[model samples]
Target: MASSLATLIVSSSFFVSFILVLQLSSFPSCRADVGTAASYSAPYLPSACYGREATEFPSSNLFAAAGDGIWDNGAACGRQYLVRCISAAQPRTCIPDQSIQIKIVDYAPTATTLVLSDKAFGSLANTSAALINIEFQQV
Candidate 1:
């Protein structure tokens, strides 16, 4: 019985490890895969003061949530980046020369995606889009 129990435990451990590997493989690789962004409104961020770390939300009306990997221990917090719409999925649009300056206020720890506030997103892309491909550089 002890031998049988040991075998069962070993099998379970192997199965769990295999599953973890499969799950991680399905996640997007961290690289310059062309970042994307989605807009969030006041409803998603109820408080204007709700940010990773800021004495008070800035009055510029521009802010975003850095992606999980890019957040980098809050190194991006309060940092301004210039974001521009590069391209969009069909049935959507991308305006050349469309750009906006945004400050990082939250974390988006989910690969190559930035979560922008409605005001910030709207400044560059169509407000109705669920997502938009973008290129950003620290400014």
Candidate 2:
């Protein structure tokens, strides 16, 4: 009788331990499923940064010449930058016009306007060398 009682207790303890382990293991999957469902419901929320609405950017009087430290006309400027459109009337001039921060690396100079490097242009506008009026704030 004593041996049987000990065996029963051991068996019950083992079953309880196994059940606890299984419950704990399932917790992570349940949490993950909830997170995935939430993400699927609002897919655009994560990309909201890339789709800011159009807003008027205030113009600054300071205009740097090409090759100057500030403007550099695409020569001396840093390989990366953030450009914000200050002009309200010329909103579409900056494609992806929604208030976006862009990085600039290369230079393309045209008749009336100077263009940012390809990488920089990609941040703000999808088109390359397209004329767009923008004011840049160095990051």
Candidate 3:
């Protein structure tokens, strides 16, 4: 009976590990780029891409303002990126395993690579940080 129980436990463990691998494989994986980001508040109107008439903030409040590197001459207006906080000046500023899908609704002439909305920034990391290292992949 002891040997039988051991066999059952090992089999269950293997089965659970296999299932986790399968589930993880189903998620799309893409190459990520290292960059820096900061948070910005509302008044995102008169954006470089949309002009004064358009103010379509995603209801999710997950949006960002692109920098010159990603402006792409206004071509990156509606691009969606999956952003994750990788590091920060202060420890514990980043939330582990947290990422958010955000739309580029505007552009910023500022130096920050991305100016994420308040909600978006807070969701991934501590908002008190003026800047944080990020890993981003276009999704």
Q: Against the hidden reference, what TM-scores do the models get?
A: 0.63, 0.29, 0.75
Instruction: Residues 1-139, candidate 1: write the lDDT tens digits.
Output: 9999999999999999999999989984543336888877764343323633344466777888888756877787777877888887755566669777888777766765688888888887777787888987776
Which wins on lDDT, candidate 2 or candidate 3? 3
Q: For candidate 1, which ten residues in a row score worst on lDDT? A: 44-53
Q: What lDDT score belongs to each candidate, Candidate 1 first?
A: 0.75, 0.36, 0.89
Query: Which residue runs does candidate 3 get wrong by more than 4 Å?
Result: 1-29, 53-55
Displacement of residue 133 (Cα, Å) in model 1 is 0.8
Name the best candidate (by TM-score): 3
Give candidate 3's root-mean-square deviation (CA, Å): 7.2
| Residue-level lDDT tens digits of model 3 in 1-139 | 9999999999999999999999888874657898999998877787776777554768898999998878887888899999999999999999999999999988888777899999999999988899999999998
Stretches of candidate 1 above 4 Å error?
A: 1-33, 43-55
lDDT of each residue in 63-96, candidate 2, tens digit only: 1212223335444333333454433233453444
Which of the two, 1 or 3, has more lDDT? 3
Candidate 3, residue 77: the lDDT equals: 88
Candidate 2: where are CA atoms >4 Å away? 1-80, 86-114, 126-129
- The alpha-carbon deviation from the true structure for residue 83 of candidate 1, after best TM-score superposition, in angstroms, is 0.6
Count the clashes in each prediction: 2, 7, 0
